[model samples]
Target: MTIATRRAQARALFDAGVAAADPVAATTRALVQSPVPATLIIAVGKAARGMAQAAMAACPNVPCLIVTNDENAAPLAGAQVMAAGHPVPDERGARAADMVIAALEGVGAGDHVLVLVSGGGSALLPAPVQGVSLADKAAMNNLLLASGADIMQMNLVRQQLSRLKGGGLLRIAAPASVTALILSDVMGDDLRAVASGPTAAPLGTKAQACNILQSFDIWEKCPRSVRDHLSGVDTATDIPRADNHLIGANPISLRAMAALVPDAHVIADPIEGDVAAAARVICDAAAPGITLWGGETTVHLRGTGRGGRNQELALRIALEARARGWTAGWVCLQGGTDGRDGPTDAAGGLVDSGTLGRIDNVAALLANNDSYAALEQAGDLLITGATGTNVADLGVLIRP
Candidate 1:
């Protein structure tokens, strides 16, 4: 097959993957199939609007509170839709979190709280624990982002810092039958880490937070209030056990993508660490057939270049594949299911053998962390604008 055909096939596979991970269909199916009547629907994250609509369809007239980022905001009938800051929290996020707490308060024995949890929820809802201010939390978040801490580590610290996380939400709605419908964004679908486990269980401790902060070399940099709070935090007791269901995630998307390719093999190890290393590992493991991967990767911003982790990883794969002198007919598409990568308008990047040859300054672009510019110049950037469903990122590699 020609390189063009391979690229087309990869794009087709990505489209299929995204369809499988769409939160609207998954949320409707999960809730409608269960046939549970929820008293209140609390949908949080980038997919909040979509998930909230699905919940309304399933339950038909439930009161809802949809908290999401500005880009993901949409109108919902009879639901309070509040737009908040994302990838970082603000006062609006803090208020929305308080609203969630107030909305859940005073629930009775049989009322069910249908909690829709998805990616970006952690930033969309910011309820700092007592003694710690929102500014402190934001500073720590920026620090963590700069430190290249993945979702798990960032959430481990976030869970400790927030009053609404780590099973705290479940605790607030103690007697109510609260069931969470989670769209997994973090690796391995660890509920405790997703959205810092608002409706799930807590797996982190204050000690762990301290260790993480110290390991990141930010312990001394942390605000005094945050340090004091962590130092004196007690092991929370009597926290309610978590009952959450997965509606969609990266694995689900990967499965749908795999169905399009008979010989597709999904790599078991999650794509993590630096983008170049991940690309090398994926290229090495891939055979003369399609390979599927689902997970989020990190990009430690070396230079002030434009691109998300997906774009950088895609470009890295192209650069590395050329370095290794792979024969032609190889294509890789890496993109976030949510259709937004980092702060850029592009979802990610698509790269092939042709991509490396198109750019004379490929090394410089990689060094400057400017895959966005290079990929855009090559007409290889994937731009799909807020997909209204985030289940981490989906990657497809084709080797012929």
Candidate 2:
């Protein structure tokens, strides 16, 4: 197949993966027989608007509150859409948390509260525990992100420092039934890691949180409130477990992509750790037809490079392909299911045999972590503009 066809096929596969995780369809299917007698729809994360819109369709007059990132914010009738920061907490996100808490507070015994949880929910709902300011929480989050800590580890630390996380929201909404429709972004759909388990119980402890901070050597640099909160004695939060439904996830999207390509094989496990390492794993195993991988990757951000993990991974793959001179006509795509990667507007990057030919300074671009610019120059950047869903990142490798 030609390079153009390979690129189109890769993007088509990705779009299929995203379509499989559509929040509207997923939410509608989930609520078909579920008992949400009276819904105070509280949707949080990147896909909050779409999820909330779906819930509203099911219940026309149901009151809804959408806490989502700015890029994904869309106007929905009968719903209050509040834009919040993701990957980091901010003052606006803090206020959104207050509004979310307020919406959850009044659900009586006869009411049903539906919480649409997706990726970035933790940061989007930045309700710091008493005595912790938004700036303090944001600083701690930056430390966690920079520390190369896994999502679970970072969430463990975040849950300990948040007021509405770690089952805090469920506790306040008690005496009423709560159903959380979740879109899995973290590996294993570990509720504790997905948005810091806002409506779910934390499987970790404050001691673990403290250790992570110290292990990262950011304990001293962390905000005073974070240090104080972690140092304080643990208090038991006895909250009823909200019904968490895994509406969609990375695996779900991966399966969809796999079905689209003949002989496509899916890596059962999602990729993790450093982006370069993950890129190597995919680059070293590009088979004919399709090879699918799903999972989130981390970037150490050494240089002032502007790119997300997916962009970084794709660029690294291109670099590796150039070094090894992998089989001709092989194309690979690496992008987020949420349609936004890191600080750039592009979702990810698509790399082929010809991708690096257009640029002489490929190594420099990769070194500076500026894969977005490099990908754009090659016309390989994947820009889908907010797919209205979050199921982590999905990758496709095509060899023809």
State every prediction's TM-score relative to the real structure: 0.95, 0.96
Taking the tens digit of each residue's C-alpha lDDT, what string does model 2 give over 265-365?
A: 77777888898898788766665677899989888766787888999898888878778867789898999989899877999988888888877598898
Query: Which tens-of-lDDT digit does each residue in 304-362 have in candidate 1?
Result: 78878999899888877888888887889999988888778888998888987777687
Top candidate by TM-score: 2
Candidate 2 clashing pairs? 305-369
